[model samples]
Target chain A: MPEAFLILILFQLVGSALQTVLHLPVPGPVIGMFLLAAALLWKRSRTRTDKPASSFDSPALSSLSRSLIACLGLLFVPAGVGLVTQMPVLLANGLPIAVALFGSTLLGLMVTAFVMHKATRDRPSPERIPDTGGQVL
Target chain B: MQSLSHTLHQIYARFLPEPNMETLFWLSVTLAVFALGVRLQIRLGRAPWANPVLFAIAFVALGLLITETPYGTYFQSVKIINFLLGPATVALAIPLADSIRLVTRSLPAMTLALLAGSITSVVSGVLLVLLLGGSHDVALSMAPKAVTTPIAIAITTQIGGIPALTAAFAILGGIIAAMIGETTLRRLGITDWRAHGLAAGIAGSGIAAAQVAQRDPVGAAFAALGIGLNGLVTAIIVPLILYFLPG
Candidate 1:
């Protein structure tokens, strides 16, 4: 568990380094996510011919990630707890914010779904889409 | 019972002399409350809107209020939880990696959909807020309402919005999506599980993804994809979008 966590934190550190050096607008954790994904892809490809290979595919990493994400709801509670202090602000601007949030969320959901459905109409199911495995090799 | 209370008060008073020890108290309180909230959610059959986070927040907030503990004090003690957000955010890549094949295969279509969805979320949110006479900060915060709370909070910070408010709005978005996202998609004739999950996950983030997970694994996978990609895209583009907006 500790090792898996270290890997994640290391990825985050690298991401933060890139963000700080490049002055990117994106968050470090997001860049870290991309980096981690890239690393996993690289590992998966390298170990494809080998039998039961690559630590990237290890159950520890997968389980650790799952547990971390499972508790993700709880992780956000501290910030949500801060909401008590903002009740006044929420109450004051509640009407407008509510309208905007409700309207935009609905619109975004509808348009995104429509676009994806249209785009994938002629394609295979998303689950069956094959990986671009050999392209990098 | 009286002796139990006396012992608890004694233990609390022992920590009173040390500032650092108070961290333990608050952390314990948070975890205990949050765990109970989760148990309640489970017992309630995990209703879409019976959000555990909402319950925990309300519990902690009310606990602080009734005990007359300041928000800052409670937050300082539970800062450890906040720090975990970074690792949690990084962990999001796990699901993304799992779905990377699907994403790579449908890269163009998915990219287009995400870009359109992300831009629509920010633009419509900002415009609505401005049109409704909300402050500039509110507009900026609301712009990232389509993504998850962590990413949304970060985007809000970068775009000069209030992070706390942005977090609240993100949760609100999730609850709303959990309630009506599937129904709305069905009404629109979008029966595809992937499309339904993507819409809900994109608009509502992790909470909506969890809700989708309860019904269908494929839909949940798509929702997870939506959460990761929408968060990444929104984080990258929201600042630029906000910069160009009139607000």
Candidate 2:
């Protein structure tokens, strides 16, 4: 677990360095995510014949990643609490902020779902087909 | 009873004056409150409105208020957890890679949906804020409200938005999505789990994705994909759009 954490932190550090050096618009951790994904894909392809094809074949790394991602919600609590200090800004633009957040979220949800549903309606993907199999009640 | 109370208070006062002990106290309090929230959320069966983060924040905020702890002091004490967010975000690559491999066939449709949803989220949020006479900072912060918190913070800072405000708005947007996202999709006659999960991920991010994961593993996988892809897409396009905007 410690080794896995070290790897993640190293990737993040490298990503942050790259962002600073290259002036990338994206965040360092996000770039780290892409880099880690690319690394996993590369590692899988290289070891394909000798091992199983699962990208998450390493137990330590896989479990650690799963736990971290699972608690992604908890990770935001500290920052969200910072909102307490921004109470004045929030109060000043209360109506617009409220409307904009709720309205845009709903609109974004509908547009994504509608477009995805319509685009894939004619040809249901194989993975989604099984989801309906157990729901035939 | 009076002497015992005085003795306990003396111990606390002496121990808390040590910087390390104070840090430890606040850190433990943060985790304990969040754990209580998780328990309450489970007790409530993970209902949309029973969001653990929301509960935990409210509790912690109340604690701070009662104790009169400055936000900066509390933030400094809990900086370790905040630091972990970076590595945790990098850990998202595991599920993201797995989901990409699983949903290759639906990649095209998923990509299109992500693009449409992300663009709409940014444009609608900024436009609505401006239409309602919000300041430039508020509007810029609103641009990345749909992205995940860490990325949203970075994007907001990049585009001259207030990172703290963006973080707050992003989480609020996520909670709102978790509360009404499924019902809204169903009302619109969209029943496909993929679409449901994708929307939850794009707009609601982790909170909504966690909600979708309760009954649908496949949908959850897509939600993970949605989170990562939308993060990338919004990160790219927000700057591009702002750059091309008329000054």
Best by lDDT: 2
The root-mean-square deviation over C-alpha atoms between each candidate and the true structure, in angstroms, is 5.5, 4.5
Q: Please, what's the RMSD in Å of model 2?
A: 4.5
| Predicted candidate 1 versus true structure: per-residue lDDT over A10-40, tens digit per residue | 9999999999999988889889988998888
lDDT per residue for candidate 2 within B1-247, as digits (tens), equals: 5576566556667668877887898889889988888888768865677777778788888777656567898889888888888998899888887776756878788989999999999999998988898878899999999988888988898889987788888888999998999889999988888898899999988888877777577778888888888999999999998776543
TM-score of every model versus the real structure: 0.90, 0.91
Q: Pick the candidate with the highest DockQ.
A: 2
**What's each prediction's clash count?**
0, 0
Q: What C-alpha lDDT, on a 0 to 100 scale, does residue B188 get in candidate 1?
A: 88
* Candidate 2 deviant stretches above 4 angstroms: A49-57, A121-137, B1-15
